[model samples]
Target: MTRRTRRTRPSPTALPGRTVPVAGSIAAQSPHHCRTSPFSSRLSYDSESMRCRKGRTPRTLILPLAPTGPMIRRMPPLLTIHFLPTTVESARLAGTVAVMIDVLRASTTVTHALAAGCDSIRPCRDVVEARQLAARPPACPDNLGPLLAGERGGTRIDGFDLGNSPSHFTTTAVGGRTIIFTTTNGTSALEHCRPADMVLVAAFCNIRAVADTLVQRNQPVHLVCAGTDGEITAEDCLCAGAIGLELQDHGGFDTHSHDATRIAISRYQQLAHDSDQLLAELRDSHGGRNLQKLGFDDDIAFACRHDTIDLVPAFDTHSSTIRTLS
Candidate 1:
């Protein structure tokens, strides 16, 4: 039988020419009659009691509490794949690392040449340019004159020391010699990507090295495939896809899922399980078939091998040279 005293709500009080606040409510003022607080945008102070310009009274606006907790940060995608070298726009290549893939021969040959202890490889546009560069007088007595190396129609050019096949660049043959190299597809692809911030050569042989380099640099990447002739070759796309897959497996890159990249990745996934399957797919590719027809079946097998070489070759646009990435 305990009796409790009833609580009453406070009544609204008014000051002269002012609207007083009531329980749980603030006085509302017209925007014209209020001054914005300097400390916060959500706060405002009453000025004088005045009607709005439209002759309407002021209405109250409940300022919501400021949001809390950790802010969400979005990371930009770190990888972009271009199925063909020609697809790379100069504008997009401006500030990104470019990875050029020519697994059928040029990229693989260059990787092997570097691995064989060659000083550097200069990628020239054609056989004539390559020969001219090689015959140029050496700047220093200690410098070995360039070795002319190139292929035409998948055959070793007449009078050139080596073909585009990786086997030709053995340690005893190319060690410490500068190579003036040219090829039908790979060198042109390298030249096309010269405008990029940095250009790195990649092939199945050096895939892991290139992927690790890309992850270490942690920059946006443009994967450019050196297609055969004017058409996209399955080998090039497959190599691009393999590089993308390696990036994904390393777990830091936000890979773009554009149609070309997606197609490459899809093609790679279908053949990634079996070594023989991957090689078979490469041999069936347009470039692969061409190489095989030219009696470069060994080159196709060599190019299809994964992670055999651990060197990352970088193309220097200034000198038009490809050297091992330091």
Candidate 2:
């Protein structure tokens, strides 16, 4: 891709860091697909397995919707592509809809499992909580177990039935089951969005479905990038950028944006033409490299393919399960 915009360095606050929120809908469904460098492909993000990685700062940048420049026409679009700190306390999340992106696996797995006919998914913060939730598997008629899933350090947690890989969420394993998922990056992001009016999970595989819902709802859009290990990851930002672009193209969001939003849009513009190459190249990122070491290259590719499913999992704050929005 020919470079168009000059890449900007991360602000001191956004210095290389570790990390990883979303939901309601138009009741429509479709099927889907994360990260990379704003400029250098060498620093792009490809995997969602960096939660246990070490020594990274956490930061956030907001493109406030209030008009601050003449470049913006009329009122700003209700969308704000926020590059958020991987924490639950940020105040920017107040809104009607939050689209959570954790393309490496969490969001991807959640979407796939639900599509595979899982009853629902309850995202937990820790193994203990997930285990507790697992004990009472929603009283399904099938008597299937509530799946205890997640990972630490890219390996499945001891005693859990599954890891954070989308491949593990096959129909036979997850169908008719409720999944209590706890992941290093994606789950915490889900917790962060609990206060929002709606929380929707987004991954490459279901990007079109999520985007279609966003286009129908005239509410404010919060693009939440679930970063790697509480630090910023390129893949999440790329996903956010792609979501922002789709919203702009289909949802009538204004083009005016700032800081992190601009960077995300720019990065997406560069990689949108050839997502396969984008995914392959980004697998070089720390998260991607780590997952490959753990033998999840296939998982990465599977997660990268766009629009293969038609389910939009929306987190229900009251019920605590993310099911298809419809």
- The top-ranked prediction according to lDDT is 1
The C-alpha RMSD in Å for every predicted model, in order, reads 27.5, 12.7
Q: Give the TM-score of candidate 2.
A: 0.74
Please, what's the RMSD in Å of model 1? 27.5
Q: Please, what are the lDDT tens digits per residue for candidate 1 over residues 1-326?
A: 12122121111121111221212111121232112211122223323321111122222222234468665444644788887876877667878899999888899889878867788888889877776777673452337677888888889999988888886776667878888889999888888887788999998766767877887677788999988896888888887888887666555667655677767877887776655667788889989999989888867766765654556899998877888887
lDDT of 2 by residue, 1-326 (tens): 11122233222222111110011110112111111101122122222321111122221222345456444333435666656545335456676688888888798889878766778888888888887777766775467667788998888999989998886676667777878888988888887887777899998666756876775665777888887776677777777777777665553565455566777878877766654556765587556777899987766666665544555799998988888787
Model 2 ranges off by over 4 Å:
1-76, 87-89
C-alpha TM-scores of all predictions: 0.76, 0.74
Look at candidate 1 and give me any clashing residue pairs: none
Model 1, position 50, has a per-residue lDDT of: 18
